[model samples]
Target: MSEMYKKEVPLYGDLIDLVSDVNTETLAQQPEIRQQLEHSGELTRLNMERHGAIRLGTAAELSMMRRLFAVMGMHPVGYYDLAPAGVPVHSTAFRAIETESLNRSPFRVFTSLLRLDLIADEQLRQEARAALDQRQIFTDNVIDLIERFEQQGGLTKDESQQFVKEALETFRWHDNTPVSKTLYQSLLAQHGLIADVVGFKGPHINHLTPRTLDIDTVQARMQGKGIAPKAIIEGPPKRDCPILLRQTSFKALEEAVSFQNAEGGYDTGHHSARFGEIEQRGVALTPKGRALYDKLLNQAREQLGGTPNEHNAAKYYQLLDSAFEAFPDDYQTLHDEGLAYFYYRAVDDGVDMSTAISDLDTSASQTETAKQAIADLIEQGAVRIDPIVYEDFLPVSAAGIFQSNLHDEKQSDYQGPSNQQEFEQALGAAVYDELALYQRLQSQSLELCLLALDSKA
Candidate 1:
C-alpha cells in the first residue's frame, strides 16, 4: 500500500455520510426511487469492472471502496464464507439500501476480500499473508468519523463538500504504479467479482440478477434448456407467502486470456469463470412469521415424500398456503391486509373501504378472496416481492458446486475444529444461537418464490 493512497483516501463509512446526508427523503417516494436503484446498480457494475482488482487488495483500495459505496448509501452487513464449499474463494454478500430505507433496515454491500494466498507462489504467499497480518484495515479515526456521521446524518455545507470529494477519491485507482505480475494477480482475485481477476486478461460480467416475479418459470425455462445451475436457488420452496430470495447461476463461457509469467513473458490461453446469475425475491417477513413459514415448508416436504422438483414446486406451495391461509392473529384480517411488509396508505379518497367493498370485484366463494386479492396485487404492482437475490452461496451448495466442477473435492483435508464463538466475538457480531432464524429466512423466501408461480392450486 502506498502512502499517497493511504493518507489521501476517505473510508467507506465517511462516504455513506455523503449519501445519507443529502436531503433526499422526498425523492424516495417518487419514481426517483426506481431511478436511484437503477443508478446504484449501474454504478456497482462499473466498479466491478473498473476497480475490480485492487479494491480488495491493499488497505488503500479497501478504504476507497468504503467511501465509494457510501456515496450510494451502501453499507457492509453480513460475512458470508463461500469457502465452506472448499473452492478457492473468499467473499461476503450485502443488500445495498436506498436512501429512504435507512431507518427500516441497513442497505448493504456484500463486499468480499479474496484470499491471495490461495493463488500466489509459496514465497509470495508467505509475504502476502504476513502483510495482511500486520496491516491495519480500518483506522480508529475512520470508524469514529463514520459513527458520528451516522448519528448526526447530515453535516454542515463545508463538511458535505469535503465528504463528497474525499469519497470519490476512494474509488480512484493508485497512480499507475507498475507492480509485479504476481502481486497484481493476487490483487485482482481479491474482489471476487469474476474469474478473470485471477491472472486472466479477458474480463466479462459475472452475473446480472434480475428480481423476477416468476422464478419457478424462469428456473424451469433455463433448466429445460439443459442449463444445469450452480446450485438450487436457496430460500424456501414455493409457498403461500413469497420467500425471501432464490438464486441460480449458469456455467461460465470460455473467453480468451493472456497472463504475464514470472519470466516477464506472456502466456496465452482461454479461461472461464464469469457466469450469468438470476434471482427472485419476496417480501421480508417478520422473524416469527418466517418461523411458521419454515415449519410449513418442512410439513409440505414431508408430505411430498423424498423427491422435489420444479413440476411439484407449486403443488407443495398450495399445501403450505392452505395450512396458513388466515392470519396468525386476529387484529389483521384479510381485507385489512395490504402488502405484507411494504407500508402503504390508500391513495383513492372519498371511499370508505368497508362500506364500498362491493364496488371492487370480489372472488366467488369457491375462490378464496384473500388468495385472489394476493394474486391481483401481485399482478397489479401494489404488492412487491423481489426475486431471490441469490447473492448468497450456501456453504453446502458452494461445496457441492466446487465438487461438481473440480477434479477432486477430497484433495485437501480440514481437520482442525472451528471455534465459531471466538470467530463471532472477534468480528463483533452476535453469537449464533438459533436455527430458527435461518430456517425462517429459508421458508419465507420459498413461499414468496411459490407465489411467483402462477400454476399454484
Candidate 2:
C-alpha cells in the first residue's frame, strides 16, 4: 500500500509524544533512547566526515529508512525532488531535520537518495523499470505498524520497543547470497542486489551531510583530499551573507556491493552509485521571506547563467539589490498591497505618511529610509546576504556525480521530455510547500533531538 493510503502518519513530534512524554528530565534516564539518539548523532558526524551519499533503491528501502530512523524515534515529514530542473536525470527526495536543538545539538543531515530507475534513456531504463515493477517498496507489515500507531495515537511502551527492534533488524538485512562465477555476472546484469526480493540491494548510508559554518573551507578541504567538489557551491556569494545551503562532494567511491549475476550466481564488486555530498544549511525561511528569496534567485539566475563565477555572483547581487529597492520585500509586501497569500503586520504610526509625503518632492527621498535600514544593518553587521541554499539540485552536478561513479550516464536516448508532475503523482506526493515543510520539520526535529541529547547526559 502507498504511504498515503496506509494510514495518516502523525506529524513527527506528536508521534513521539504519543509514544511517551519525553520531557527533558525523563529522557535522561532512558539509556536505550539515549543510545539510539547517539547513534543518530554518530550518523550525522559520519555524513560530515565523508560527505552525504546514500542510495534509496526501492520502496522497501524507503520504508526501511522511515522505520529504522523511527527506531531512533524519527519520522518522515517532507518530500522533495530535483528533477524539475529538466535536463540530465536527477530526481532525489529527502526529509530535512534540525540535527540539534537551538538549546541542544547541531543540525542533522538533509538526506537525499539516488533515483536510479528514473534514467532518461532506454536500455538501462528498461532494466531499472523492470526491477521496480517486479518488487514492492513497502511491506504490508510496515504499513500495518504505522497504521496502528497512527490510530492508537501512541504505541504501548513494550510495543514501541519491539517496533524499534524490528525496524533496525529489517534494515540490517544484507546481501549474503552464495553464487558461482558464471551466474554472478548474469545476476548482476539482471539486478543490483544479492537479494532478489527487494530487487536492488538494501539501502546503505549514501551520504551524511554535515552543517558547515563555512562551506568554502569544507569544499577546499575536500579538494585537498583529492575529491573534485561540486562545480557550484550554491547560495549567496557574499562571505557575510547567511548562506542557506552550499554543497560539494568528492567523486563517488567505487564501493563493493553484493551483485547477483546471471545463471543464479553472485559476486562482490564495486559500483559508483554512491558519492559523498556535504552541505551547509542556513536559517529556516518564513513563507514571505522564502518568496523574496526565490524571486531574488530567479532574477539572479536570469541575469547570470548557470555557473555564477565570482564576477557573476557580484553582478547578480547588485541587480537583486536594485530590484529590491523598487519592490517591497517578500509576501509581506504583497499582503500589505493586497497582493499575496499570507497575512501581514500593519503599523499604524497614527500619522498618515502618505498624506505627509503628498506635497514634497519625495521621489528621491522615498527609498532613503529603506536604504538606510539596509545600510545600517550592513554597517552594524546585522544584515547579511542570505546564501542561496542548494534548494534545487543542478542536473549536470547530479549527473556529474553519477557519471563519475556510474558505469555510464546510460547513453541518454530519451524519447521525450521529462515530466516531473507525472513522476510525483505516481509517488502520490505533492510539491511541498517549502516554507511550511521546513518549519514543521525543523521545529519537530529541535524538539526531538534536544530531548534525545538531554537524555544522553
TM-score of each: 0.45, 0.51
TM-score of 2: 0.51
Candidate with maximal lDDT: 2
Global lDDT for candidate 2? Answer: 0.41
Off by over 4 Å in 1: 1-60, 85-109, 115-124, 127-205, 223-231, 289-340, 344-457
What's the CA RMSD for each of the models? 13.6, 13.6
Query: lDDT per residue, candidate 2, 347-404, as tens digits?
Result: 2223233322232232332255633432333334322222112233334344434433
lDDT against the true structure, each candidate? 0.40, 0.41
Backbone clashes, each candidate? 28, 33
Error of model 1, residue 262, in angstroms:
3.6
Q: What is the lDDT, from 0 to 100, of the residue 159 in candidate 2?
A: 76
Q: Provide the lDDT at 308 for model 2.
A: 44
